[model samples]
Target: MTCTTAVLLPGTGSDEVFVRAAFAGPLREAGIALTAPAPPPDGTALIEGYLAAFEATAAGVDGKLLVGGVSLGAHLAVEWALRHPERCSGLLLALPAWNGVPDGAPASVAARISADMVERDGLADALRIATDGVAPWLAAELNRAWPRHAAGLAAGLRAAGAHPAPTLDALAQLRVPVGIAACTDDPVHPVAVANAWAAALPRAHVRETTLAALGEDRAALGRAAIEAWQQASASQGSD
Candidate 1:
């Protein structure tokens, strides 16, 4: 039997540990083989690095491929899937950060990072503060793996900074089935943005869950996302 495969990409300042904690266990229970690739600690070239890693891992595969990510990763997944709709069997996007204000309109981690860079001794401290507040499960992983994770953060920051917010016009054209799982009150990924993406994608299905339901708890979120994918895949097969 050919194994169904998926690539789970994490958000900015997040690494494999974080993504694994959020996806691995639950997806395994659901019988999906997902690989969470590690991100460089510095996050400087995260998007390109992640895309390259994904391509490398998927080499020689000829079965259905699912690609998904959280926040900035989600945006990248959507962008890549749009470019290769024939390759992507489905998409799972959670908490897209693409709809937020630009680099200087507050809520802009990009602006904060840039401003902090101006200080000789403040950037490191700021980066610590910015990345430390992740979920405890993730914090434990980050503590165990700092340097490697830091490189990913640097690359992710660069990716997020350079990525432009996706428009409905662009998303509406994608034919690949999509599943959007959103947090109700996440400022970084507002409910409105998720709703918009769901509405825009031609074959998009949406599910709304809370942070409390997902925090440090991968089972709830992963199961929900997987079930959505199963349903979408089933529906697509039926039609």
Candidate 2:
């Protein structure tokens, strides 16, 4: 089935602008309208709130829609699609951060620690630590975006840290087209997780790229993955 519309969700601490930067143009080129909503104001109940918003948004769409997102967003999208299997035409899940649970996942670990630190020490000290200790670009990005939404960021992190991914059985039931993308060298969104997802999902195709390339062109990651999935579908159809 062709995807007419795709509702893309941003990961923890990410805003609507980041989601648009990640997908809008490429999805539009594929004739899909991208609907990316802003994160809810309440951070404490973020995952539940965001998923509810995603479901509401998907329900409002005229046709069967593609649902997916980055990190926490991607994990919940799988759950979303399965819950309303009839509404999902496809999935554009980027950056599968962890497997079944949040335990031992780097992203989760970071989220929990960050959330605890932010809660206890305040956003200023937390920001200072992150901006000083983390990578140059990330520190810059966080500095620019995190101050205003410190509470929201901490809440999203705490929520994500506790969330779990869809079980293997749930993934196996997803027969629609799936485009999974991840960065090979990035520790947060690992290639192994993408490989596991590609193996579990019946119709998933994966594309491996680098963090540098993604930093340079965010749209390229989605473009490559969707194109690969489309090519695989075409090949299978001809066969």
Candidate 3:
């Protein structure tokens, strides 16, 4: 339950800078040293790339690690923890976008749609269309990440869409505590996904967040995850 070291990964197209801003504050408060590494670039083996990244990071750590991430990164976090339960002390799954499998998952669907657009009209058009109606911060992030890795990110989404994600049966058997956070107003990462995860995991907690608040303070996402983990740990202890 004492998580001194942790590794965090960013979502598709995200770099280390984005993940650090999202995780630094809360992890520091918890006295947990965090290393947010950028996942491998878009490749044929997108999932495997992330899985390997998790393995490599945990291998370098001296003690049990708290692993967590956002969206696709979150998916990889749970998948890795399930495989090497001994290495994972806790999980902070923020904005879980897929459940059971990636087939027809909303997040993957959106990613694929974006990919198709980029492939058809090119990155500039895709970025302009995406950031048009969104908030400045959200638009800025989309502009920053999407253009940087448009092609690879699109390919990564296709691979992720074909992934057979963790099922409820698998989640029920998770050995480490879990904290699932979600933005209620976010369509891509639905709140229902987080709720389902919390209900299925034997020791999972949910922290409902809002898109507006998340836009205002990116660290709020990390705060929600850390607080939910603490709550889940407390409830398990009381039992």
Candidate 4:
């Protein structure tokens, strides 16, 4: 049986391949249609760009539309949901970053590095730093696609640092339910941010799981995320 359509947005410097691994199989198995945009190169315009992409996608699909993302993707999802709560059915947020730029946020450093990359080495240097110690396959892929990846991260970092503090007062008005999944081992997307989102969104249900629980395997993350999505969606149906 087909379920509602859901859009999955990748994090900073991430491509469709990475996000597809994380969500496509699971979402497809769950009978959810998936839509994802290529990451924009300009860090500053990232969220607005994503919002526009989502708007275009939402226009094409019928019925309830669930929006989700990882890291910067999650941030953009939340921002969009805030603006058009009625248009969204629910949210599947994974690895959300800071509520806003906190002191010593890595985004600050990333932004600086991003500015430098556009001029000389391009994304080569930043891509090395962004994916250096990540999963080997992921790192290798980023190494090959460094320029495009770098530009997206540069734009995301600019967006992250400049994004205003998210207020729940607007989110509090949302009738759409939310599911937030956090990776305990993630340094970039902290658990605190997930907890904050849970507290802020009146209908948000949060699950804090370890990377090990989700496994290094992408399928594992997708499975765990689906479980959370089920619980959140079920609750919404009940309400």
Candidate 3, poorest ten consecutive residues by summed lDDT: 37-46
User: lDDT tens digits, residues 71-177, model 1?
Assistant: 76677777777777666778878777655334442224653463344243354565466456666654554445544554344445545666665677888887766
Candidate 4 residue-wise lDDT at 114: 54
Find the 10 residues in a row with the least total lDDT in model 1.
Answer: 99-108
Q: Which sequence of candidate numbers ranks them by lDDT, best first?
A: 3, 2, 4, 1
For residue 74, what is the lDDT in candidate 3?
Answer: 84
- Against the correct fold, how does model 2 do in TM-score? 0.91
Which ten-residue region of model 4 has the weakest summed lDDT? 102-111
Candidate no. 1 TM-score:
0.80
Candidate that beats the other on TM-score, 2 or 3, i.e. the better one: 3
Segments in model 2 whose C-alpha atoms lie over 4 Å from true places: 133-135, 236-239
> What is candidate 3's lDDT per residue for 132-210, written digit by digit as tens?
8898888888888775664576787677666666787888888577887899889888898899888889998999888
Whole-model lDDT, candidate 4?
A: 0.69
> Per-residue CA lDDT of candidate 4, range 61-103, in tens?
8765788787777777878877777678777888776665545
Winner by TM-score: 3
In candidate 2, what are the lDDT values of residues 83-135, reduced to their tens digit?
Answer: 89888877888888887877788888888888887888898898898678566
Q: Considering lDDT, which of the candidate structures 2 and 4 is the better prediction for this target?
A: 2
